[model samples]
Target: MTRDNGFSRRNVLRSAAALAGVGGLGGVATASDGESLRQIGPADLSDVPTDLEAVPAAAVPETSSGIGPGSMLFITPPGGGEAACTANFVWTDDSGTTYLGAAGHCFLGSSAAGGTELDEGPDLADVEVRVCVDCQFGGLSALVGGLRGEVVELGDVVYARQRTDDGTEVGFDFGLVEVPSSAEGLIDPSMPTWDGPSETGEINAGDTVVQYGNGVVTGETVLTKSRAGSGTGNDDASGSWTAALLAAPGDSGSAVQVGELGAGGLTGVEAAGILTHVGTSGTAGTNLQKAKEMATEAGLSIEVVLAG
Candidate 1:
């Protein structure tokens, strides 16, 4: 499985549990309103359905637009702080609402009122989604906190959830941030360094995988943001998979694609999963297919928004 330097990532998560701000990271960019917002935790695992609706394969459109996969997501929860997470794939609902994919844990802060589990709660509000925040300026620009881009006011957290068994976060922690029509011009469905996630596919134990994340732990540097690693296969019945990729605290919610990185990044890539848990065993991801199933159970009629 993906391994880090035994860093108590869970502790980092809890300490920075709100997953709310970039300001604390020093010059990363700050929320303008600076007002308090709501925190949504994961729903019960049993709430997911046994028989889920089959989502059709992602349809590749002739054209795609702006900031999307590989972009940074800034979340500000109720406690008045902001956190950063990497945007995964893009999705669209039947109603024409565009949603950016992220780890459910990204919005999780402290626990729902009166709830003890970290992964239990309702939806989130006032989330600030910034696409290409400092991507154009490159890592140097981001490091010095020069020209951080504008915030894209995507709609609220339409659907977010995580699954845990016996109080253990086994897998399946993912969420969707609805992109408003005004921000459509900035919504590109393609992965940045590595391109095609032509369709959703499975990951085998030995298959190679590629990912790009904008975690603060890596200073949001381009060099370490994109990585390639090997899969360790799926966890037993948890609808999650493990990998040997390099990951850090803010790397959560990054997309994991099944493919190989050629001289020009990933070639013939397929969306596999979203990085959720990073620990001693490895980096665990909620399988892309399983995530869809859970979304279906939540009454969301959506499909992966493929790149051009």
Candidate 2:
């Protein structure tokens, strides 16, 4: 997901979540007035009967917190000070719409009480974010990706969940950050096919193919078990990668390519909705279709608005 903030990324990071940011990430973001603003790319808060509604998929038990922090981990951009508490974020109906999001607040100081004080100024009042879900979460790289983001055993100065002002947030961990180039990383392979090339499907067992994302640069086969299916969850096909490519936290919302020449015309991409799985060690999930909806919901559609 993404957002526009006049404030330098340096000023948009908070300190509280910084500590837990890298380790155990909880809900975080910014807000304006009484609304919680979100920076995540085009996401639809519309309560649709999506597959995500039936999370935990059939493979993973519903009771399993295998999805969000409970079901699994979903990536969120901080919208306020060092502590983008509830105040920092503002959602019209608590359903998180990206239009009102602000990253400046995410980088506010510890003293910024939720949003009592527009600590970071008004730079981030509005912006757009791009993201993809339902792509690579459950397929194969889940376990490895989750554990990898959870903890990197790199000894001293370990930057697991370290907080960062806009500056540092970009490289929070050894992950790839998809900075909205074209409408590329923001489409769902499963949703209706886009104009030119498009990709979709589940990265699960018996799914032979290679994936391309910021992580493990080289294309590699999917790797994992109990992958995500047609649930309300991500459209990312799960799989087991025998080769070695890595997925990192910053790599969320990146592209996931599978096809001939080790590249398909278009498929789902990668996202961070998968938080528990051995195979996901270095990867995540993505759904371009959802991203389009989000864009439309945030008023950043193709008709008008700033360049996405």
Candidate 3:
């Protein structure tokens, strides 16, 4: 996930202090107007459905089959901060274990500096990852269920070149998370709101593509256009692609699918890359091919689930 500058340490600490004053860290409270806002715990999946069949017959949240791009993922790092990012595709390992792909930095305490591997000291093995079940195309109002998982594994941190707020070109980030077995059946291998059951391929410049992310406002059904291969050959960050897609702080880990628009719409869509960082001009992503290779090196096999 992109480091939210707005959520400074001082602000976070202040929020924690305020919560402590109100009740406890994970307490629930009602505003003076009577609206309820509760502190969510790792096990507080009360809003999530316990059965896949129980999900409404509506959009079938991106977490389900036709696993769409903007699926909402709630990530709790080991160090005690909670954040959210969008999930990419659903893949299965050689042993038939399923996992949802996402940016690895979602579990980090801070953004990794350019040219460095993500420090493994955060104990990501138990990092909490959850997906909302009752999501719609424009909002997450329907209360269905939540699928909870953990970050069982992660990919290498490839340097993503981008210009900072001050226009300084610097290196940045990438990674993935594994969905637990318990929540596997709740999701499908399809891209939400688009054409899919697609393949994985390289993204070329000027290539029209669709980007998905679940921002705080957009939920998990937001879609935007991006042109791949736009910033190719201009930087040393090999195996990475640049696009003009608009991304927010919560859009980290969103997917960049490569495909063509046909008469049927979004035909041949496939997993191309995972959004790593949002720069002043556009977003940078880690090549999906490289991600698969990294998974293999780590003793895992991944395949995009296509709509049959």
Best by lDDT: 1
Give the residue spans of candidate 2 off by over 4 A: 1-205, 208-245, 261-283, 302-308
lDDT, model 2: 0.22
Residue 244 C-alpha lDDT in model 1: 75
Candidate closer to the true structure by lDDT (higher is better), 1 or 3 = 1
lDDT per residue (tens digit) for residues 1-308 in model 2: 11111222332232112222332122233211122211211111111111222212334322221111111112332342111110000112123211111222222222222211222222222322222222233211222222111210011110012123342221121111122223223222221111112323333333322322212111111232112222222332221111112332222222222323235553323222211111221232223333333333433331101111
Q: Measured by TM-score, how close is model 3 to the native structure?
A: 0.62
After best superposition, candidate 3 residue 159: deviation in angstroms? 17
User: Candidate 2, which ten residues in sequence have the lowest lDDT sum?
Assistant: 151-160
Question: If ranked by lDDT, best first, what sequence of candidates would result?
Answer: 1, 3, 2
Residue 286, model 3: Cα distance from true site in angstroms: 0.4
Better TM-score candidate (1, 2): 1
Give TM-scores for every candidate, taking all chains together and pairing residue i with residue i: 0.70, 0.27, 0.62
Model 3, 150: alpha-carbon shift in Å? 17
Which ranges of candidate 1 are over 4 A from the true structure?
A: 1-65, 113-120, 126-128, 133-147, 217-219, 261-265
